[model samples]
Target: MIILFRIRRWLFKYIYHLIIILSLPLISLFSYNHLLNNHYHPKLINYTTLNQLYINNNTLFDNLFHSNKITSKFPISERSFSSLNDDVFQYGCRDPIMESSKNKRLNAAFVVLARNTEIDGVILSMRSLERRFNQWFNYPWIFLNDEPFNDEFKSRVEEVSSGEINFGLINSLNWHFPNNLENSPFFNEVVENQGDRGIMYGNMKSYHNMCRFYSGFFFEHPLIKDLEFYWRVEPDVEFYCDLTYDPFLEMKKNNKKYGFTITIKELINTVPNLFKLTNKFIIENNIKLPDTWSLFSNNMKFFKGENEINYKDVKNLDDFFRNLIKNTKYNYAKNVINNNNSDNDKQIPSKLLSKLNKLIINHSNSLPKSINEKFNDESYNLCHFWSNFEIASNELFTSPQYKAYYKFLEDSNGFFTERWGDAPIHSLAAGMFLNLSEIHYFRDIGYKHSTIGHCPYNSPNQLPYIPSDKFKHQVLPQDEIYMSEIDPPIKNPLINSNLGASGCRCRCPSDHREVENSGGSCSSLWLKLNDNNFPNSNSLTNHQLNLDLIENWALNSLMDWINNNGNIDDWEISQSERDLLSKNVI
Candidate 1:
């Protein structure tokens, strides 16, 4: 009886192996035919139709990624698998290194500010931009550095790119520390105070030089002067979508002067003196002030039924303001924030107001008195466009108005005596000089640098059916969503906030935590899909069938599939096709 049972087990195992071997070719043919016919219904999609759809979907992904709705470990599910199909097509096509379009009208290039040590990061950013957007347009790229780029850095970048490339060195004059101040008491005090504050690069003279150069000198560089527009790219940044349309052309058509993807409040400590300096500039240059400027002034006359200040006193206010800041501690107001525990107690008190009155600026009695409240207002020095990703008219930076504005600030010596970031400097230039119509928020472009990312939350199609755990540290801000006719009302962030909380290190808000012991769809799906030792109870023949199918699809082309199957459309995608692609078989 034992001999008979052993013989029977051996026979079963052998038959299973034979069946898997016999079915491999048939499975491959089926998967090939399914992928070819599934979405290739001419009426539904072709390369042209899919290209436009991919662009729109890519924009949605931008918003999704930025909001941290997706993360590095996130996996594509059945629903999202189709959305990412363009990426597969791009890989399979081995598309030619596209030549610049002969009829391309806009003269634009990507400008990179980087160091030689950052070559690897720069290459990665370049590859992403090329794969996502620039490959088709073939826009030139200009690399700028304080020091000359080495031969190796130039060669690597050139090899990866087909576009015209130019490398330039930052002029020393633009990078020079403010002169005649080596022994100045105030300058030394500023440096010492900054070092004590623990601000990143606060004590570094090179960082200050870089900030000042970018503020007033980059667009003036000889390499960029001939171009009408530029897209500022940096090392290690990511571009996450297929940019089917030309953004430079979009800027030209719409008459856009500046475009940015992210805007956040700047650290108040970095620019304590910036607002005062700006006021002085307005007075010296006789620059027309925007209505929002009233937000900074305490004059009741500007408000109906409020008292007005003496016009003469306000005009001669520069010296008084200078004296106040000179007497004030560096970043004094910001330090007060850390000393105080309650946000509601943030109003500038009577003593501070009395002094500020002499300077013609007062936050007391303002509609929103605290930094957190009026953060988006131009009067608030804390508001700024994140400048890492910028698309703008070259004229915006080189125009006479901007030059005069920058010169006025430079003369104040704020760049060295105080830490002023280029982000706020660029933000102020756009906010103060350009009309609202000329400034654009490019929510369509997906961008990531460091920890923060953003995507437009407008289209329902833009969001995944399943939320990603990427926003584990910070809950997605609901207010950022822009509802459209087609977009579904935004999902409640709280729903997914707690899905995997037990493992998350972040101290997120309590309301945002996942329900105890309950794993939501995103977390559950992530485990099932990503675990290398995923539990499987399938027969050997079925496993072999899936492996063969995926292998045939990736190595073969759509043409090969179509040749085998003949003309067909609207066929259902096979289970193997969906699983294989989502599992990274292709």
Candidate 2:
């Protein structure tokens, strides 16, 4: 009897182990199906219970792993379950390296958007500039992709752009973890997490790259580190305004390092993960971070709990991220208020806020913008549009002092998560490191999905803040570009794009250094130019004019176009700039 009982116990143990093994694939299959059958969004939970589950060891795994039975389909596949390593995208490099530093070059390359563009978009955008203002493509364009650039894509861009292009490959290695799915330790758990919006716990290479971008900025990519300036471009992008000065020259003169378009509350989708990495940074980098780096509110309304929100209150954030904070007049009055001794050195309640903010932002409280202005050394500030559309020489990129740039990004394990992209971080880093006067906001460049804008002649400090003139304090040094407003806005527009399409213009309102183009729609000029009969040729090429005359003609013509077109759509050409720029026939 005793022998038989012992045998039964041993058999039962073996059976249990076998059952667990058999369930692994089934779990993965079911999880994948669930995600495919449903939309990928997290169900709401009570903050108290969420906190409890986070701390309670027993409920932690169960709550996190409890799958929500849902399904998804193919078209969504591209944007779906980015955390998994199943499939990814690729970017292209037009040719090898056209230019590089003498003693440096690594696996570095910039990803420029160059796909799904209009048939005559490139020519049209260029022609729009030419008919209105003859100009060359100022910034180097980079192309990125999940697949290789076919002859058609490459050939088309080459012919249209006159070979003005470079490419980056977003292969499995670069876009995702190098680990194999079969051998991964977290295989089961990753399967369980398939439906999660945040692509954590899997082989999401782009996510990883984005994280590293925020924390470990890349000044050393084989393609980028050696070059000081990178002008981010994308397919189907547009430029409606005429440029009077060289943005690249301004960037060099002022010492401004990075630039960007928008700044939203970075904590929305990033607080939890940002906290995870930031905590690691505190413990690992050995650098002393300021107090108030991470603060959370009990109220969800502030962060647009369930819907898209524009922030109306910039004054309430200073105490939460003290180190990176820029105390402007508006900030002191709006953000800091009377709290003289707020404890800024506390953990930010990352998980408390949702990814959206419903607040109606008051730009009047912002700092002066450098939209149409040139760089001014006396004040040493860099605030303007297309801050991200940059131009840098090899010398600026290879500077030894720039070592800190990429170091910060790599250390944060930032390149491993998909929740955050590198845009906001890059903007912040540039604003902080680049000299104020050296920074520039390109007043001419235009992108369809841009968040920042530098209108012609709109110098820094031209604009007033949204609420209080004192609210200008909320911005960081880098964000000087979007700090101020000249006349208050009727409204601020939303700028968006595909993944890495245009660069990630992260919403780090914490620094208030966002670049924006009050573009609720296309500039009126673009609308006039959209007529099929718009000039398809560059007449300036045949003119016997000197460089100065060429530039003046272009500038005046562009201004005329803006006047006639009313500055609404980006490239509409129905209204001509000055009835006619020149009568000399091409």
Candidate 3:
């Protein structure tokens, strides 16, 4: 009996040990997975947890990742830690105060022109805007389509929008080629030629129709006509930052007529004759040029025998003209410079000299023969506020001046033959009609459309860490960082009070910089012409400033000469200098 009892005890002890040994691998695997699923997966962290983390400590990382429990159990390398912080930085910190109903809302609606196939893309844009801005204001949205919106598109968009949603069919007259031109062979030929030349959206009749519609008729639509203001949103575009305040209210409060986020040069080929047509209309109607007109006019100054053609002042003229001519075709340079004057030594007529100066300054090597030939003395700089995104009072478009301008362009058939884009049209009209102060640049908004995007960074003083080669791949500890850490804590240039954070919860790249002067952006020119402050303007060298000043003087002189009917007497040149000018024909 004693032996049997001892044998049972030994078996029980050995079996228990065997069971624990068999489960060891499984237990370790489960533990590892749990740590990864809970700690590594950022999506698992809910907004509530994030808000809690923010509340516990003002910083996102100090409380959550820096906790000893998480650090010890799930070790993170410095690079991984930095990457995690970057990922969190994208969400930015949201402001609950933005949810207050006491905030005044604007009588504005978001206008989207899309087709059924773009429903998914439209949903993304709608959801992004709702989360970023509209959730706070609850403004209504109006969707316009050439065809009826399908149930799926309507339901899906409705599901994402926080505000009341309405769908309307665009009038056929507004969205199609005019009945007179629909079957015109000339129109077809132009389309075919532009397509063959590979102009963006040049061959697509529907694309041109869409551009024309947006430029002339969208604002007049019944659904949008009643609204005081409209924000044009497009499919697949993204709003990367939180807009804590109502942009419509901002527009109204500041008496702004137009607002845009991205400014870029238009494809010169797409709008070959637009500038000429616009110039002609201005002259015929005696349209008063706005101060902002300089934004569109080329600022290059070519000597018109105004000042004694000092060799010192014109030393760089050779290189400047050389580079300009070299970039364009030889034939084009000849056409612009020849001016039918066979005699090269005799004094050129003041009229001919003025024409030559205007041609040289207005000419752009980038333009094709078709476009270059249309350059007037007051040439378009082609710096246009991209129209894909616009916030403006509806009154701006419905005004008689803009209406007449649109009608003139439409009657000329440039929208059909030349594939003129609405972007440049809107830009030119705004420059002509609105004051510099009336047109707002939404610098605080972070936006991305296809390849081009603008991601804003805080001022250098407000940056949490100044990126350097030494810490290029490292994220500094954000412990004990207060909102005051950002010098001034509130930098809303437009609004004086502390409203919801303007760019809160942005998920853009930490290293992404604003390409204001490069990559086809013309914001630099816009700033210089309007005298608005540019971020990098202070970095310009004194030599660059001198060159700019010279160009400005030249532009003003040329305009004055033209306005005065080529009279050199107004220039106050001495008779000897006038003789010297007359002796040379450039």
Candidate 4:
């Protein structure tokens, strides 16, 4: 039995990896005809050239291995544990007067989509989180689906959670796209030409935007406001920590508003002079910048690009922002520009100040959207948006911020239509503007929900469904039920007393504890059935089967699922055939 189990596990591992790497579309072209739906009667032999895309090929085993990278042990020093009080990371130090702690740990829930096989790891990670922070969680749980949360999925999830797990019914109207909008010119052109190459390109663009727009603005919607931190748990993700700390407070205290696990450059050309524009704004508003805002350093030295661009010249967006920090007006340095000697570099002065001002003036005169102060309004800071990781606040999603970030970057996609993702865009924005103290890496602490071990913890060997005794520390409610009421929001420190801004960790840690840490879905099978995930004949058939289930004309959740669910079976059509079918169906 042991040998058989090991064999089964190995088989599952390789098979799953191969499937993702080779792709269902490729599999169908080579082998899966038997899985095709019966009614795919096509009138013509659809064949078109697939514009093959070449990416920096990441391998199957490496991809899988990367998922296991979080640390299993905390990296704190002996001095850390001995000198620091728990109050820094924990909810309270027992300050009896101000109620010690507000005691408002969220009854946070997760909404994950799954299909094919049962996903067991995600729930297990959550169980671990509850056990380590039971005293902090004061809320319920919710699970949703594009399909019914089968008894198997629900029971298994609840069993591991050790808490009430409520399953939500995704109304079809809320789940799928309505078959109207054929009247609107833009959307109509999108629909009518979908069968032509015209539609596939557009749908792909629109679908990508759907995720980006949501990541950028989901907080304003009524659906998730009650929950303070919605830790997005996707299928096949991992976690590894006791999580004795509360991230929400970290976000609150240091004003490390937006939290992300990974950072990457923005698509070039999306916002070319983004940096120059920011400098313009700062100078105009006379906002006090970090002290290190100087461009050059040393005894008459030559830094590359020092003659033209004040900061070191760079080819990638990451380097550009990395250089921006020195010119930032509010850092560890207080002297705006103190080189004890006379400097005559024109480029140096611009990068330090003038270039950014130029962008501000140009943008101010160019667009209305860029002019709105609400563009920087704090109300929209989504406390739980994730790109490669979680972003806690609205600290990085400003228009001018994005505009200033793309100076050295260019959109990979030539048209620039499907270029910047919210994650990359915001990362650049924060990189150029955020103070290092304002960014909490939680290196010593960790979390469990990110992919490739970008989180704070270790990946458990058990399935996502297993709620082992290791997770016993979590506190659970007796009733496997949830109240239909929304949770009261955790108070916003920046909004209440501060003027749309939270104080930074600008100073040093008062306690040693403040020093210890850092660390740290598909629902669908909840997606609507789209043929592209299947091979040609099979995909054609599933399209007809799912036709009647459509609903919600605007934020059509079905359209999203069809576009994203990794059924892979959909991408099997010959490039031309896929285009024709995608255009007509989507």
Model 1 scores a C-alpha lDDT of: 0.52
Worst 10 residues of 1 by lDDT: 498-507
Ranking by lDDT: 3, 1, 4, 2
lDDT of 1 by residue, 1-586 (tens): 9999999999999999999999999998787554333320001111233225324522222222211333222311111221110111111111222213434748889999999999999987887676555656678889999898999999989866647899999887777764657457877778777978986677887788888888888888999888899999989976533344566886777777887766656676788778767766776777775422321322211111111121112111122222222223222333444444357555656664444343233332322323332221224525567788998899888888888888888888888878899988887777568654566555445566775554322221232222112111111132112111122222324332211111101111212222111222122222222223222321011122223333334334333443576221212234344333323321
Locate the minimum summed-lDDT window of 10 residues in model 2.
70-79
In angstroms, the error of model 1 at 234 is 1.1
Candidate 3: clashing pairs of residues: 90-507, 91-505, 92-505, 347-582
For model 4, the stretches where C-alpha displacement exceeds 4 angstroms are: 1-121, 124-139, 142-151, 162-210, 253-255, 264-388, 391-416, 428-438, 447-451, 454-586
Tell me the deviation in Å of residue 500 in model 3: 18
Count of clashing pairs, candidate 2: 130
* Per-residue lDDT over 165-232 for candidate 4, one digit per residue giving the tens place of the 0 to 100 score: 66654444333333363234654444334335442334454443334433343433334445555544
Report per-prediction Cα RMSD to one decimal. 26.1, 27.9, 17.9, 26.7
- The local distance difference test score of each candidate is 0.52, 0.32, 0.61, 0.33
Between prediction 1 and prediction 2, the one with superior lDDT is: 1
Per-residue lDDT tens digits of candidate 2, residues 1-586? 9999999999999999999999999998787554333321111222333335334533212112211211111111111111111111111111111112122322222335334443344433433322111122223445655456667766655543422467655444444434674246554344335326553433453344434432333334455555555555433344433233334444544454443322223323432343334334335545432211111111111112111122222221121111112221122223322232366654323331111011113334343343211111011111122223434343444555334544554444434433444544443334334432333323223333434332221111111112221121322333233222111111112212121111111112221211221222111111112223223221121221122332245444434554585331232222132123222222
Give candidate 4's error at residue 95 in angstroms: 17
Residue 143 in model 4: lDDT: 56
